[model samples]
Target: MQAAISFAISLVAMSFGIAKLPLGPWERGFLALGLIFVVTSSFTLAKCVRDRQEVTEVSSRVDKARLDKLLAEHDPFETKNL
Candidate 1:
């Protein structure tokens, strides 16, 4: 969600900056906002990819038999005391 917002902000800012090139306001604010959004989205995407990779790596190392055994021990319908 944040990545999407950042991308949108970046696009808007970049557009503003481009539009201002002809009007002569320089659009410094929009340009800076665009840069910030791009950086933030890049970092967010990198972190998400890293997390997904870690999860995939861990899942690949799991022992199916042990997992089944653990699941078999649980009673899904039973209520437990906290």
Candidate 2:
């Protein structure tokens, strides 16, 4: 799924062009640079999002384990002596 989405985004960026318009050498270079920047940024942003999600999941698991440990050791109502 991620691969499909990445391909689609890159395809759209590559489709951009001064096709019929008369552009100088420098103008063409800048346009190409802009396209590259957009593609790179999209990939970078996706990675950051994935990294954050993984971190959140790990943190949640750790929290649950801590809670479980505390509950196991807790002695509510102090019913140890009869």
Candidate 3:
């Protein structure tokens, strides 16, 4: 919800600022398109980074759990440490 509101406000501000610029229709359109591309790419990059980190964390957790399970099942007295 907060993000939605912030996005709305920023969009409105950008529109107003762009309207004030003394640019032709093509130029304005290009500017808007560039802004959209930048914003979307930024979001995509951030999400990709976050997803990678999450995958790494999940992988590490799975590995840790597996190791813990193996340790729990092993009998220290009768087992050869390998």
Candidate 4:
């Protein structure tokens, strides 16, 4: 929540700053487009990183479960027929 609020504040501040720039409309439009691109790219990167971490966590859990199942079925004192 805090991070979201901060992002919103920053975005608004940047927009206002860009609007106040002395540059012409075309340049301001370009800068706004660039800012939007950067924001979207950052979101995409963040989502990718989060998805990767989640996948890793899920795989680790599956591996742990497999190890536990194997251990549960293991016996130390079982007799073996040769």
Candidate 2 clashing pairs, residues 3+ apart or interchain: none
Give a tens-digit lDDT track for model 4, residues 21-78.
Answer: 9999999999999999999999999999999999999999999999999999999899
TM-score winner: 4
In model 1, what is the error at residue 82, expressed in angstroms? 45
lDDT of 2 by residue, 1-82 (tens): 9989989876665655444337887888787787778878988999999999999999999999999999998989777665
Model 3 CA lDDT for position 71: 94
Instruction: For residue 45, give model 4's deviation from the true position in Å.
Output: 0.7
lDDT string for model 1 (16-51, tens) is: 666667544456556666677877898899999999
lDDT of 3 by residue, 1-82 (tens): 9998998899888878777899998989888998789779978998999999999999999999999999999886896669
- Checking candidate 3 for backbone clashes, the offending pairs are none
Error of 4 at 73 (Å): 0.3
Best by lDDT: 4
lDDT of each prediction vs. the true structure? 0.77, 0.82, 0.89, 0.98
Listed per model in order, the count of residue pairs whose N, CA or C atoms clash below 3 Å is: 0, 0, 0, 0
Arranged by lDDT with the best first, the candidates are 4, 3, 2, 1
Runs of candidate 4 exceeding 4 Å displacement: none
